[model samples]
Target chain A: MKIGYLGPEASFTHHAVKGAFSDEEHVPYTTIPDCLEGLITAQIDRAVVPLENALEGSVPITVDYLYHDADVHITAELVSPIQQHLMVHPENESRWEDVGRILSHSHAIAQCHKYLYYRFRGRALETSTSTAAAAKYVSEHPEENSAAIGNSLAAHTYGLKIVEHNIHDYHFNHTRFVVLSRNPILDELRLESEAEKTTLMVTLPSDDRPGNLHQVLSAFSWRQLNLSKIESRPLKTGLGNYFFIIDVEQSFEGVLIKGAIDELEALGCTVKVLGSYKKYSIVQK
Target chain B: MKIGYLGPEASFTHHAVKGAFSDEEHVPYTTIPDCLEGLITAQIDRAVVPLENALEGSVPITVDYLYHDADVHITAELVSPIQQHLMVHPENESRWEDVGRILSHSHAIAQCHKYLYYRFRGRALETSTSTAAAAKYVSEHPEENSAAIGNSLAAHTYGLKIVEHNIHDYHFNHTRFVVLSRNPILDELRLESEAEKTTLMVTLPSDDRPGNLHQVLSAFSWRQLNLSKIESRPLKTGLGNYFFIIDVEQSFEGVLIKGAIDELEALGCTVKVLGSYKKYSIVQK
Candidate 1:
């Protein structure tokens, strides 16, 4: 099976794909929208893309594209603990202290800003398109004598040596990647999954009505459905028009889930079932 | 009284200040944290900063700073209709096509990406520190023959002429700015605020609990205290941990809102009242 990922081959997303589906054929797309677009267009059998980071919140571009443009459904969720590391090209490992610049994605750099400020005070920070891209750049230009901050997988993939492990500010950094496919996943994705979840988007009527959100939540509330997450994104229609993305902790085939969605639609809400999938956890190496 | 805003000058936040507090002294702080820092340190009586955008959702830096770092209170919310315009220095106004590059803040540029692709496809797009800064750069280097995408305030302040109005992808684009101070707002703001609001931060126990969010909403749902927004941000703890920022459309002085707060506290949830204040809307010029 061909599984595509948001990549320059060594991103956290790429690492997730490698750990979970190493035997499968892998394709890399440059952007999140391109990855999803590839799935809907049948260019790949499955696409793995970052949905949220524990520290950074939702990946807005991914969510926005899914809500506004893409017609793909999530088939499985891969949650990987993110551990940003400081690394240098193998040739520069001994003289890493002489590094003059640090390169990584903006988010990765922000995650380790304090560490950078305290230890690498005088070093310049430059943002690459992705953490993996930073790793690649450092590998290709070892003479520049710069370091890259990224995952250990990046270090291994780009033949670099990690000088520091888990330099992120918080110990709880993790990223959620969702597997998108045009049809329900049929391949035997041999991985351990502890829970099943169904995602839904509920859009309230445009007219501002008091308690409208409460009513929307009530559909699932009374059914005793446990929601793992609920987020509001603007409908892009106006100031008050919002569509709530909800994650219900249950199988999509359940009658209760179907009933709640039916009730929501009955209430003049636009409801879309974005996914019903199992959640998998990847242990950090 | 003195007011601080996220600025260079002529930023949307600065424009909001000028429109609402023409009589007060205005000070410009380069970043949101600096403005809020100025407020907490008593350097300024009030600080105005962007909170959320109708299209882009919440600004992470402002939200993160408030949640994890600042000991500030929101006093008022200023909702402004955002209208991005394509403008050029007066010298190049007639020959805009000759303009080689378009400059603006990253967010502003993303807002008009579609427009730029269709109208100015080959022109280079550069990101300035801020929209107002972009305008200043354009004004300073008219010989460069560049255009900028920013609010009307930037064009007017920089003495440029707007060639295209409302070039943003979404016509419903608006940004929500919150006024922050060390105390509740005391100055006569001299602007029309239609409704009062109370903002609360509710953090569930670290232990994952089913139906906890539903119960939290029930506290307000039963009271019929209309909610304007509910956003979840990671508590900087591990996965599945979140703190909900709820906006109750009511006054701070209300007994019912107080009852809800007590009920939440009784439920063993950590709840903090961020603010109970008014919301003002700014019309586009």
Candidate 2:
């Protein structure tokens, strides 16, 4: 089977893909939208992309695109702890401080702001398309004085040397990635999951006032449906307009889940069942 | 009166400050934290900074800093319509297509992706410290052949020509700015408000399960207290650990808000009242 991931190989998403789909053929898409578009358009059997990072919050593009464009359902979640490192072309190992510029993806760059400030103060920082791209650039441009911040995999892939290990500022630097497929997976491939989760998008009435959200929550509360995550994204129509993305800690097959969704619909909330999926911790390769 | 705003001048935050404090002395700080620091350190009378945007959800730095670092309280909210424009150095105004790079703050650049994709397909897109900085860069570097995406104020302030107006991809482009002071303002100035709002940060028990949030909402729902916004931000501790930022559409002086906060505390949830302040629509000058 073919699996797609947002990558140039050795990205954190690529690492998650490698950890989860050992037996499958991996396809790399250049961007998140392209990865999702590939899933819905059947370019690949399934697609995996990062959803949220513990320190940085949600990947806005992924969340926004899921609600606005994609016609896919999440089939699985992959959680991996992120560890950023500073790397350079091996020749720069002895004097990495002389590097004129530092490059990495914006998120990775943000994750290491403190390390960069204290260690590489006054150096120019640049954003590449991906952390792997930055690694590749450093690998190719050995004549230039530059370093890259990326994962260990990236350093190995690009034949670069790690100058600093685990340089990310925050300790709990984990990112949650999700697998998307056009239809539900029927256990065709062996994917180990620790728990089950069902995600719902709840849009309150346009004339929604304060207590309206309380009413929405009441539907699930009385039924004892456990919620794992709840987030609000812009409805994109105007200021003060929003729709909540809720994650309930159960499968959609249960009657309680149905009853709660029904109550929400009955109470004038526009409800969309995004997925009922399995959650997995990464098996680091 | 003295006011501090996140800026190098002509930024969206500066616009909000200008609209609200017509007679006050305006001071510009390079970053949000700096503005808040100025407020708390008494270097300025008050600080105005962007809290959230309509198209872009909450400003993470603003949200996280408010919850974690600043000792200031929000006194007033300023909501203003955002209109992004494409501007070029006067020399390149007639031959805008010849511009080699398009620069703006990351958020502004994201807002105009569609416009940039179609209009300046192969141009290098760069991130400046702020939108106003982008305009200033283009204005000062006329020989570099660059364009900037920013507000009309930036173009006017930098003496650049606006090649295109209202270039943001989304229509409901608005930003919510807040005034931060060491203590709550007691209507010392004539700041007209459409409504009163109280912001609370609630940290659920570590062993939180599904229905915990539902019970938390019940405290407000039963009292008929309205909530204008509800968002969950990472506690930066670990995955699955979150704190809810709840915005109630009422002042903290009321018994209803006090009752809800008290109940939440009794339920073993740590609740912090971030602010109870006036919300104002921009009195655009």
Candidate 3:
């Protein structure tokens, strides 16, 4: 299967694509829109995008893209622990205080929130995608006292040294990525336990249109479907437009899920079932 | 009064401050942390920060700040129409297509989502805060083809011309900014209007613990107090930390509001009433 992912080769999205399909042919796109376009045009069989970062919250573009293209279905999902490493030139003997600026993906900067403020103090921290890009920036701008926060893989790819390792505030810092495809994959990877988590996307008519949301939530509440997260993204194509992404801990086969979806459809709005994935289980400390 | 606002100057936060207290001394800070620091150090009387944008959703940082700082009260609020303008240096003759890159604040890029795809299709749009800052980069790096999205004032300040006007997708796009101060300004703003809005910072015991949120919401649900927003932010200095910022449509005087607060406090978690203020009305479209 040919899989498309957002990247300059080794982004988190690229890693997500690899995690989803091992032997799949990887097609890279510079922008999420291009990756989406490829998916719509059938240039690739499936695509992966970061849905939410523990640090940055929701990926707005990814949510917007899924809403715009109704045909795509999220077939699989994964939450990878994001371990951020600070990389700098090997010969550069710059103290942490001397560093004028640091760079990483915006999410990385957010994950390293406490550490950045405590260690770097008042220095300016900028953002880019893959840690590899930040490493590249550090290499090219060697004269400036700068560093990058990314995975250790980025340091190796761009020939930078690890100034600091695991700078994220939380060890459980994980990014949840989802796989989207035109056709649903039967017998997709699942735990021995049946998948209990399901995701859906819906566009609300208004942002502050008074208890309009309460009405939508009541459909789920009435049926006793537990909502995990409800995120809203502005609809890019139209004014005052928004897409609400909801996650519930229930199966589509159940009465609650079906009834909720039926009520939503009855409201004369579009609702797409993204996928059902078993929530990740980590051994307790 | 001296007012602190989030900025490097000419930022939306600055504009918000101007809208609320035109006669107050405006102090600009580069980051939200800096603004908080200014407040702590008494560098300014109060600060205005974008808490929520009607288009892009919540300003997590501002929300987090209010959540962490128990002493800070939201004294006043203002919601302003946010219209973005494409700006280019006056001396440069770069056509829209000729521009290799577009630069503006991240939120600005998000606001013009439709226009970027439809009008300036394929051009790489980067993120910065001030449009004047983008123009400055273009001015210094004359060979690079870049334009910026900013207010008309920024275009004039940076000696840039308006390439396109009002590029936001939403005709009624607005961002709500909250004025925070060390001491409560409730009594002062109350003379203008008796109806007040209060914002509070809440730290839930667990993010994923089942029914914990329901119990919290039940407080307000039982009393029928209208909740305007429920926003979250990562705690800046704490263990396993996250902050929940909530906006309610009524003052603490209402029995419902007090009951909700009493229940929230009974949960053995931190509940800080940031401040109560006269709810500012948005200009009619």
Best by TM-score: 2
TM-score for candidate 3, residues paired by index: 0.79
Query: Which of the numbered candidates is closest to the native, going by highest lDDT?
Result: 1
Per-residue C-alpha lDDT of model 1 across residues A1-285, encoded as one tens digit per residue: 899987777878888898778899999875565567678778899999887752222266577778887788888899888799999988888999889899986567766756876888657877565688789999999889999999988899989999888898767656788888887653346777767889898888766776778888778878888787888877777666788888899988899999988888888988998888888888778
Q: Which has the greatest DockQ? A: 2
Q: Write the per-residue lDDT of candidate 2 for residues B70-159, one digit (tens) a residue.
A: 777888888887789999999997889788888876557666766776877667877665688789999999999899988888888999
- What stretches of model 2 exceed 4 Å from their correct place? A1-11, A21-49, A54-61, A95-149, A157-159, A184-192, A207-209, A283-285, B1-50, B53-58, B92-110, B113-148, B181-192, B282-285
Q: Which has the higher lDDT value, candidate number 2 or candidate number 3?
A: 2
Candidate 3 overall lDDT versus native: 0.66
DockQ of model 3 vs. true complex: 0.19
* lDDT score of residue A136 within candidate 3: 87
C-alpha lDDT (0 to 100) for residue A48 of candidate 1:
90
Ranking by lDDT: 1, 2, 3
Q: What does candidate 3's lDDT look like per residue over B252-272, in tens digits?
A: 777778877888888865787
Instruction: Give the DockQ ranking, best first.
Output: 2, 1, 3
Q: Lowest-lDDT window of 10 residues in candidate 1 chain A?
A: A53-62
DockQ of candidate 2, scored on C-alphas against the true complex (2 decimals): 0.34
lDDT per prediction?
0.79, 0.78, 0.66
| Candidate 3 lDDT score at position A45 | 84
Q: Per-residue lDDT of A34-91 in model 3, one digit per residue for the tens? A: 6767897899988776676433223555665566644777776665666787888776
Pairs of residues clashing in candidate 3: B73-B274, B74-B274, B74-B275
